[model samples]
Target: MSFPEDPIACMRSLQAEFGDLAVLEEKGQRIAFVFSPELNRRVLTDPTNFHSRFFAVRGGRRSAQRRVTSGLLSVNGSEHRDARRIMMDVFAKKVLPQYHETIVGMTSDLMADWQTGQLHDLNEEMVTFMVRMTGALLFGITDGEYSEELGTRIDHWVRQNHRVGMGALVAAEEYTSQYEQLLQMADELEVSIQDMFRRHRQAGNSAQRPDVLSLMFRAQGTERELSDEKLVGHATLTFAAAHLTTAHTLSWTLFLLAQHPDVAARLQQELDSCTAAGVPDFAELQNCTYLDWVIKESMRVLPASSYSQRVAVAPVTLGPLNLPAGTPVIFSQFMTHHRGDTFADYARFLPQRWENAKPSAYEYLPFGAGSRMCIGASLAMVELRTILAVMLRKWHFQIESGATVDGRVIATMLGPTSSVPSRLIAADQIANTVPVHGSIHDLVELPSEARTAVVRRAA
Candidate 1:
């Protein structure tokens, strides 16, 4: 199967032309592309038939890159179950408040350089912000610069993997050449992680420390003992899972709010009503129902992960079609989210639709659905709420006029292709939609406020 140049647009077009299911021949093997909630539920629920194999390439047998890449998502069966059980306490609901304080403090540090009228690359800012925030949650590191250094290395390593892996898909020589660079980055990351472990061990009473790495350390030598190699895998996976996805979500949410001034103004009102001294704590964030709706609606409209990959382990029948084993299957969240049949006025950016809406787990999955759903989802929600609350309370955000806004799906995540250069407005000033030039118009329906209408006529 050919990877289309513009995958987001291509998927949308394919779903329109070929109803729910489309199959393609990848050389001799078949690949199933399903674009409906029912099909998604069927495929995801039947993991015995469809094993979750994200990519076909593994770096080397004993390489640090291989160890780090084979995290929780890559493992299956009993190993997956035991690892999930051990990691569950790290993200439990009761400990969320501890993580909340870290997010708020880090958010404050991030905005320390911001001025009233400064222009900034909003997407880049979010990426860097999440990298630090993720580090604190994962490693319990208080040093911002050190955290940024580690996070930056991991970020570069991840970007290389996405680029090189895609090239390997088609056996491109150009991408193959960069393969060694990826491994070298991984070697550096492994050393940093070892240093992290040393610091954790040196820090007294690490068993009581609550970061993911600390908790995971406490679990070592227990019934399900994880090797040092697999420990690297877990840490890398947690960082990768939370960092970019949450960052892109924040970027997209803010961009949508900027474009829809009415929604932004209204949400700010909710923030004012719910928060104390312009910053919402975890309790206050819970009460901001409208804020919840906005996040939900934003993810539904432009989800971070467009599509996920799976492989059929056993020969199976999917509806009218019969498929052999080893068939690669792709189910699109973008296609499912944009379906007009499920969501009325689906193309419009309307936060109010989520107020009375009751979409199923499979229907509205940004963190995804099924047993292998994202582990850091709860942390992500609290992080999003905290970041948005503090930022919106301080300033209004708007993209500069005539700036080109483009979104592309890379490494299974949909985010901006270039800098979303935007200027900050005073909290006292009202924001207006600007003239944006690019492909963001292809994915989202942006109408100026004067002519805007709610998805629901009653509103």
Candidate 2:
């Protein structure tokens, strides 16, 4: 069978064609695709039987460019455990509390330039916000220009890998120029981070900072000691993964909120009531139950990563099928998340589902459930809650009419197909301009020029 153009449709078609476990031959390689939650759980949690090297290779081979060094994502066994342990404190519960102010400050600084009635690409805006936040939080870099440049370089590197069919199997030399550019950007970023470390040390304040680079430097002599090469690898991976995933999540959440005004109104009310200072601390964010539900529901509908894979290290049983070693096993979050058994009215956007129903980790694997689960999951959550709270409290967004918003799987992550053309209005002005209960379609009347601009850009 020919591969489906849409990744989600491809997976669903495979599941329906071959039931829970579908084995296909591609380029003489037998790949097993698992759909059931039980099999997926085994593949993710039991790393010994189904190893992570395949997934690591899949992530490492960006645009036919192989990674120079192995980070936590690519490493396994004792090395993975040690690296994870060392970096644990960087995202630990104790240290996250110290980052609230910095997160809030960075978010506020970005939003300060946003003006009411200004047409903005919601996806682009979120990407910019995340770039700044990730730069500051990861390397202590606060220059917006530098952050934007770095984000652009990363975007180019990521986009190079979005090819399909024979185009995806081009010679290594084809990617050399782009790959070298990415490496140069990484070199510059590492130099800046090292300089930040030096400044912190000279000022005798390195220990007081909550940034990831500082934490890494402080743990140099400890059991989690990471060499400079490993540090570069980890920092690059962290910056790319943290910002890209969170930005997509935020974009999808805002798009969904624009479609459902009642949900947005309730969320704003909850944000207003829960956060006394507008910016919420970790505790205050945790108390905002509705906001948490909204984010969770949004992730359910459109997860950042569409699928994850693991290769069988040895002979293993997945459901009724027996897989030999060297078999690549895949599990798709995009398809399984929408299963009828796990969620009632699985297709609808319902935050209330999370209020009373508790789904198992296997059933809802947004972050994945296992030892290899996303290391920065906690930090991602904090950013999502804090940023969403701040944005909803300050401004209300209305998606422009005639603008299409849909999902496109780019480099394995689900993102908007086009720029989400939207108009930003002050939250207070929302009452005078558009009824709180009005549909988003009724709120914004785009000028003909603006509509044409959006359409041309989308095309």
Output the number of the lDDT-best candidate: 1
Q: Write down the lDDT of every candidate, Cα atoms only.
A: 0.81, 0.71
lDDT of 2 by residue, 1-459 (tens): 233246666677788888878987655557688887887787887877876652232333442233423556667778788888888888887788777888888878878888888898988888888888888788776677877776666565445433321122222244434544555544455565455455556655667777888888778867446776567667666776788899999998887777667788888888888988556777888899899899998888788877766778889887777888877777878777878888887767788889887888888888877898888888888889988888888988887765655566666688776688789877753322122211211212222333454445558
Residue ranges of candidate 2 with Cα displaced over 4 Å? 1-5, 54-69, 158-204, 429-459
Worst 10 residues of 2 by lDDT: 434-443
Task: Give every collision pair in model 2.
Answer: none
lDDT of 1: 0.81
Give the residue spans of candidate 1 off by over 4 A: 1-4, 171-181, 205-210, 221-224, 449-459
lDDT score for residue 286 of model 1: 90
Candidate 2 whole-model C-alpha lDDT, 0 to 1: 0.71
Total clashing pairs for each candidate = 1, 0
The root-mean-square deviation over C-alpha atoms between each candidate and the true structure, in angstroms, is: 4.0, 6.0
